[model samples]
Target chain A: MALFFRLEEAVSDLIHDGDSVAMEGFTHLIPFAAGHEIIRQRLRNLTLIRMTPDLIYDQLIGAGCARKLIFSWGGNPGVGSLHRLRDAVERGWPNPIEIEEHSHAAMANAYAAGASNLPCAVFRGYEGVDLAQLNPNIRTVTCPFTGERLACVPAIRPDVAVIHARRADREGNVLLEGIVGVQKEAVLSAKRSLVTVEEVVDNFGPRSPNAVILPKWTVSAISVVPGGARPSYAHGYYSRDNSFYVKWDEVSKSRESFLEWLRLEVTA
Target chain B: MSYTSSEMMTVAAARALRNDDVCFVGIGLPSAACNVARLTHAPDLTLIYESGTIATRPAILPLSIGDGELCETALTTVSVPEMFRYWLQGGRITLGFLGGAQIDRYGNLNSTVIGDYAKPKVRLPGAGGATEIASQCGRTFVVMQQSARTFVEKLDFLTTLGHGRTGRERRELGIRTAGPQLVVTDLCMLQPEQDTCEFIVTSLHPGVTREQVQQNTGWPVRFADTVAQTAGPTADELAVLRELNERTARAHRSDS
Candidate 1:
C-alpha cells in the first residue's frame, strides 16, 4: 500500500522535458526541493506555473531548464530581488514569459476548476477591464443566477505537481499544519503529485486525521528530506536564512552573478 | 496628539475605508487600512490582491506585498484572470487602495517611470498590478505622506488611468469604475470633484494646516468649502496594529 521513490529519481521520471510543471510552496515554506534537483539535471524547455515563483524558478531559468514562466511576481522581500527574471524579460530573452496581472486567487481557482472537472469557474471579482486581453486563455461567462457577466477562467491541470510538506506517512499521507489554502487543490489537479516531507511517520495513526492535507490516494511518490526549504524557511522546523535572502539581492543585480549563486546553492 | 506620519496615514485610510470593498492594497498604508478593517469594522470585507489572492485574511501584517502568508491565509485563491475579470472588471470591488512613487492633480499614478517612459531620473518599482487595478476598480483610495516630490504637478508616465484624458472622457471610455475616490495623506484627506477630477481637501488631521498641505503639493491644491478634522487612532487600534507589526518582524527574524 506504500509508494516510494528517491527524490531525484521520482522527479526525473515524472517530469519529462517540455512538461508543464507546477511546484507548490510560497515565499518560504514547503518548496519542491526534489523538483529543483530534477531541474538542475538540465531538463530543457519546462513550462512552470505558479501563483508566484521565487529562487527555485530563478535557478531553473538560469540553468536553461525553463522555457516559459507563468506567474504574477517573483522576488524575495525587500532583499534578494527578482533581477534574474526581470532582466530576462526586459532583455527579451528567448524564453516566453507570460505575466498574470491578478491576485494569487486566480491561479488557485484555475487548479480548483481543473480538479472539479469544470470548464471554468465563474468569478464576479474583476468585471470591466482589459485583464482578459492579457491572457488569451480566459473569457467571460454570464452568471446564471444574477444574469450578470463573470470571468470564466480555464482549468490548469499540470503534468506534475511537486510539493513539500511538514510530515508524511510511509504511504504518502501528508500533514500540513499552519497554512493549507491551495495545497489540496494543487495536488488533486495534477496528473502525478510528489511530496517531500520533513519526516516520514511510522504509521498513519500518528497524524491527526483532520491535519492530513493530502491523503495517500492522490500522491504518487513520497520522499523524506529533513531540513527542506534549506535556504528558505520551514515553519516550526527551521528559520529562514536571512543571509541567503540578502545575498540573493546582491547576486540578482546581474545575470552572471545570479547564475554563479545558483550554481553554488542548487548544483553544489 | 503627536503621531508618526505612517500612523496618521493609516488611521485616515481606515476611517475613510468602507465595508464589502475589494481593495488593491499596497504595503504600508493599504496594509494598515486593510488590517484595521479586519480588526474593526469590516471583518468579512474581501481583499482582492494583485498577487492573485482573493479574500485574503492574513493573521498578521504581511512582511511584503508578495508574502506567502497572504495566499496561505486567503479564503480562496484564483488566477490573475479571475482577479481582473471576475472581481476587478465585474464591478464587484467597490474600492481600490493604492500608494505610489508619484501622483498628479488629475489622479494619474506613476509607479513605472520617473523622468520619461524610456529614460527616467529614478527608476522606481515598475507597475506591477497597480495600473490595471487603478483603472478597473470601482474607486481608488490613494495614501501617501504629504510631500511635493510625491504629489507632483504631472506624472512622468501614466501607469494607472485616473480620470482619463478628461473627467467626462472616463465615462465615454466605458470605465465602469468611478476612479480615485479619496487621497489620504499625513496632513489631509482629499476627494476629487465629480466633474474636474481636481482634488479638494475634505478633512485635515489634527494639528495640520492648510498652508503646510499646500506647500507639500506640486500644484495649487484645492480645499472643500467646509473641511473637517481627521479622527485620531484609538489606543486599541494602535495596540492591534503594533502587535501585527511585531509578529511580522519576529516571523521575518526567525526565518532569516
Candidate 2:
C-alpha cells in the first residue's frame, strides 16, 4: 500500500547513500523539492539518472551528492551550459562524477524494459554512430527472424525513482497531465518510487485527455509538496519561471556563488 | 516596421515551409520560424517537440521543450517512446529543423564537444533527439548564424549525420531520409550539390557579398553558377513577425 509521509521523513526513509536514483521530468513537473530534500539530508555518492538533466541535477552534483550520472542530455535548456556540471566534469571541483550516456530513445526503451521486468532493451539505433563506441553497454544484437542488427542496452532498474506530478488522490492514484515523459516507466522500473504532487485530492475527478494515472499498487510513497516543480511549471498551477533559468546561469557559473546560493536557498 | 537582417533570415526560413508540413522543431530559432509559419502562412503546419507534444500551437514562444504553453496548446501528447517509434521512426514527420555548435561543409553537425571525445575543452550538450530527427524526417532544414567557427571544414564529432557521408553510404546504413535539404543562415541560404552533396551557396541575402559568405565559412565554399539575391522580408512578413513577438510577450505576461 502507498503511504503518505513528510518530505524529510520520506527522503530519510527511502533514499540512502550510494543508491541509483532516477528523478525524471520532461521539462515541467521536475521534483525540485525532493532533490533539495535529498541534498539537505546530505546523502552522498548517489548515481542520479534522468533523460534531460537540468537545474536540480546540477545542484546535486555541486553539493557532491552524486558519484555518477546516467543521462541522455544534460544542459540548462535555453541557456548555454550547465556550469556546475561542467566544473565537475572538467576540474572535479566538488567531485568527479562518471557519466554513462545514451540517446533519448535508448533511455526510454531501457526504462520500458525495466518496467516490463526484461533484462535488456533492443532498439534500432546507434548505427554508424560514435556514441555506441564510447559506451560498451550499447552493443549490437542480430534479429533472429530478419537477420537485422539492432542496438541493445541493459534495462535501467534503479533503486529509487522520484518524480513530480500535478495531483494525486488519497487512495494514491497519481494523475500526471501535460507533457508526460518517462516518469511512469521510471516509477514502474524502480524498486521504490516517491511522487511529490502539487496537491493531494480526495478524487482525481477530471483531467486533460493526455493525462497518465499511476495506480496505487505501483507507487511506494507520496508527499504533497506545493511548488515542488518550481522553475519548472505544473499545468493549470503556475507558469515556468524563465528568469530563474537565466539567473541559474549566473548563480552556477562560479563555485563560490553556487555554494553561497545553495546554503541560502536549498540547505537553509 | 523596419526589420533587421536577422529577422529577415527568420522570415525567409518561415516562408520556406509548405502549408501542411509536419515539422520537428528545435529549441530556439527553429521554434520561432516554425511558429511564424503556423501563425501566418502555414496554418495547418504541425509542430512536434521531442518532449512528446504533438501539433502544439503555443500562443507564446516556448522557452523549452517542456514549456507549459506547449503542453496546454498541443493537439495531443504521447509518451516519449510512442513519439519516437510511431511518429519519427514510422516516417510520419515531414520536416525537421536543426541547430548545433558546429556544422561541416557537408552539412554534418557536431553538438557533442569542441575538443576530443574523452576530454573536451568545451563540452556541449549531447544530442537529444537530433540524431533521429536528421535520419528520419523526409527533409531537414538547418538554421543557424554562420561563421568560420561554426561552418567548419570538419566537425569535432558528428552528432547528426547529414549528407557528408554520401547518399550511397547512408542507404547502406539504412538511413532513408533525404538528409538536410536547405540551410538557412543569417547571411545566406545554402543547398547541397546534387552530385557531391556538399552545401553550396544558393542565394545570398541582400547586401551580403559572396566574399563575405566565403570568408565566414571555414572551408572553400562552393557557389552556384547563378547566385541570386534572396528576397528581403516583405512588409507583411515584418508585420506578422512583430505581431507574433508582441503576442508572445502578452502571453508570457498572462502566464506570469
- Highest TM-score among the candidates is held by which one? 2
Candidate number of the best lDDT: 2
For model 2 the local lDDT of residue A20 reads: 96
Model 2 over residues A1-268: C-alpha lDDT tens digits?
2488888988899999999999998888899999999999999999999988899899999999999999887889877788988888877879988989888878988999999999999877766666887889999899999998888999999999999999888888899778888999999999999999999888877666656889988888899999999988888888898778878999999999999999999887
Which residue runs does candidate 2 get wrong by more than 4 Å?
A206-211, B165-168, B249-256
User: lDDT by residue for model 1 over B2-105, one digit each (tens)?
Assistant: 56768877876886667766677766568877888777777777776654577888877665554667767777665444455566656667778887777778
Docking class of 2: medium
Q: Which candidate has the top score in DockQ?
A: 2
Over B1-256, each residue of candidate 2 has an lDDT whose tens digit, in order, gives: 4668789889879988998899999998899999989988999999999889999998878878778888789998888877877888789999999899899887888888888877788878888888778888899999999899999987888888787455345667877779899999989999988888889999999889989998999999999998988988888888878887888766655553
- What's chain A's TM-score in each predicted model? 0.90, 0.97
Q: What share of the true interface contacts does candidate 1 keep?
A: 0.10
DockQ, all candidates in order: 0.20, 0.60
TM-score of each: 0.74, 0.96
Is model 1 an incorrect, acceptable, medium or high docking prediction? incorrect
